[model samples]
Target chain A: MDVKPARRTDSHFVASLEKAMRVLEAFGPEQARLGLTELSIETGLDRSSVQRLTTTLHQLGYLDKDATTKRFSPSIRMTELANRYLWSDDLVKSAMPRLIDLRQALGETINFSRLDGTDIVYTARLPSSRTSYAAMIIGRRVPALNTSSGRVMLALREPGERQRAIEEWPMQRFTSQTTMDREAVKRLVEEAAETGYSIAENELQMNELALAVAVNRNGEPGGAIHCSVSGTVWTRERLREDVMPRLRDVANAIG
Target chain B: MDVKPARRTDSHFVASLEKAMRVLEAFGPEQARLGLTELSIETGLDRSSVQRLTTTLHQLGYLDKDATTKRFSPSIRMTELANRYLWSDDLVKSAMPRLIDLRQALGETINFSRLDGTDIVYTARLPSSRTSYAAMIIGRRVPALNTSSGRVMLALREPGERQRAIEEWPMQRFTSQTTMDREAVKRLVEEAAETGYSIAENELQMNELALAVAVNRNGEPGGAIHCSVSGTVWTRERLREDVMPRLRDVANAIG
Candidate 1:
């Protein structure tokens, strides 16, 4: 085991709290659960200390012990902890009423979004009608460069900020259909800015069609809301004619 | 200011990490962002420690700072850390595909859920529409005894465990419709067992309608998947005929 870093003579830092935060922060998208050995190896903390902390965490219900293996994994308590986010007004919770109404009117999926850096973070999303893709969670971050929701958020940003973001990371074709150049993006956003809505066809995902209208709060927004349908069922023309109008109506309702 | 708790003892605990975790954990649902003074008060850590730790966290992109106010808040990067749980196969991530299909087919909100002692934890949720009421987040929890997802999860528990649970704490209704009787709950579980799904109508929330079905490995579930809609729009007939069939269909798809 790696030794604890020698403390400064001044005891300037609370080494234990830092270590515990490291253990907490060490848990990420790739390393959700860990045994004592894994925690020891991962954090370079002594096995004894790791074991002690995990035990404490378990006692507090942040983790659970596997019956046979005795390995420690995140308890649902971790979800409770995450629930305490600053954006705790649960986009999912507040939006459900409007979201369900929109879904019923549109007969498809919808997403409630917020800006995270330049990317569009899906704070809340209704499910798509088909079963194939990955589930979009409340905190899921996808490229602002790729999603229709991302673009709308960018469109909502100040022009200078938008330009900087596009320059910082321009679009890449996720499949064959994503917009590839800054010009294409600007034109799309310009039209959206003019017409008050945007559409992306097979832009980020194969066989995905999405339409979004910015929900201006009272005509102001914390961010945007989007309603989408599968390209598999709704062709581009039908979506533009049918889905767009309903999405706009919902966006206006939110606004 | 309260004196440092860990400092009072020179025990083996790593003070810095624990203090840092407390600093981070101090930002809960009610208090999402805080200035150094607030952080100091919340964690009972000195202002300097809070400043230094938040600086490191901000540098790492896990915390964000307001330049003018110098208040520290959690960044979405914290969600990225929690997303690790969603990728753990056969744990939570494994259910995304089914969860998506269920949401899409039902055109109602769907979630991958689990039991955390007395609470039901929503790991992943597919919203049905654009309105917000039932706030959703990765680590959010609702008392298990008070929700459809919770009841379904509780029903899956070993009989002895269930008995001990109600025995330990009888149910309390959050809304008038919330179950408050332990014997009544046992009866409800019996009904749920016979019917093979769970329903909560304006129970947890007076105006929300929710139904849940467990996603089982065989007869037992790794977790549950739930669909919630606004009670205003749903009739009992619609729920029984329309929602239950679709909810069970999705449940059947569960591994």
Candidate 2:
């Protein structure tokens, strides 16, 4: 039901394949395992279609079905596709060594992300010695307008495109200190464009400050290298003097 | 073409969905991007079918197509499915804190893997400071007979199943030091059964030694926790005395 109108009309679109993917995606943190009825409800598909899709997915090794519970969860094979993506991504491959180097030098959480539609998706993450389970995970996404990496990438874009994003892209207040004002965000993007880096404080997470520099590929901004530190431990001025130069150097070293 | 005979006959099986997955999987480390003809040949499907599948996947945002080269590769959206799997997996969630603790305690690589068919696929990996890109990647599968983690899981299995795995499963020689002798591997498995831990030296890599212990879940061996060290920096006796107890403690902590 979430299929775009254009895809609905496109003859090459495989509706059943899309539905099967939806079934796999429906198993997430909140609903890790779902019975047939739950799957049908979550996917908004009828029971018969959900049954066929689940059966096909289970048979194909993408979904694991519990014998006693009859509930289905994503199988380990699902990670293989992600592995393929990681192996194939040119930006991730090129940025990894530098990201590791940055993590070692700064002893802070390092991330590489790229713009995808209206969000920035983390492609590579190297957590500091002190980090959480969620902080280390790859493939996490956030609104492009709210993250320092997103702001850096957006700042490098054409003015017209940046204006459209500022006007139209969805924005959410993740933290009390998040900058939801369009004019304020525009000023931050302008500052990033002029200074060649971006900084965000307590926007995504309270008591966290993030700094990012764009990595260029072929002449355009390919992605961003981000370093996050605890706001309680260091002041903004100290972080700028101590970390920004090294961050830029690592970003420049990457593709 | 790789569809099993049973799946081929199953009325609920979705062959087109399988074909689409195959197309996505065809893009890997060696062949990051594929033209329509290459995808057709790789997937063993005709050009028209490959074309339709690629189009469908691209429309669904799972495949990225190059405008100039007219080639397709997996998009970042593919990682979302892997993220979903990571979040849904109870074992990975439960094992993460322990794995991180072990990694910090040992200053070496740590991994959690489970058996999938004839292979053990890494579900979580925390790389040492000295590590390669391939070593850090999750979802990398190695033959269950060759890895210490795999052997530990196999050692904990029913004797009949262990014998079947030792006798029937495929084995490949990955390195000059790889233990290709079935008798030697069997002895190692038996030793693991007696010791409640497993070790492999220069088997998967020339200068690497891996140690593992089975993590039990509800009275069954759920998976194995692994710690890999440089063989040049560690001897068998030294590793046993210095590392094994801590490794076992971490493995027992996970479930």
Best by TM-score: 2
Model 2: lDDT to the true structure = 0.83
Q: Model 2, B89: alpha-carbon shift in Å?
A: 1.1
Among these predicted structures, which one has the highest DockQ?
2
Tens digits of per-residue lDDT, candidate 2, A1-255, equal 156877867877788888887887687668878999998988888998898888877877888899999998888877788788888776677667677666666767888888898899887777765566666677777889998999888988889988999888888898999999999999999999999889999998888888998887675678998888898897878778888898788777775
Give the alpha carbon lDDT tens digit for every residue of B217-243 in model 2: 775678898888998888888778778
TM-scores of the candidates are 0.73, 0.95
- State in Å the error of residue B138, model 1: 5.1
The two-chain DockQ for each candidate, comma-separated, is 0.33, 0.61
Best by lDDT: 2
Cα RMSD for candidates in order: 6.0, 2.0
Reference-based TM-score, model 1: 0.73
Q: Model 1, residue B247: what's the lDDT?
A: 66
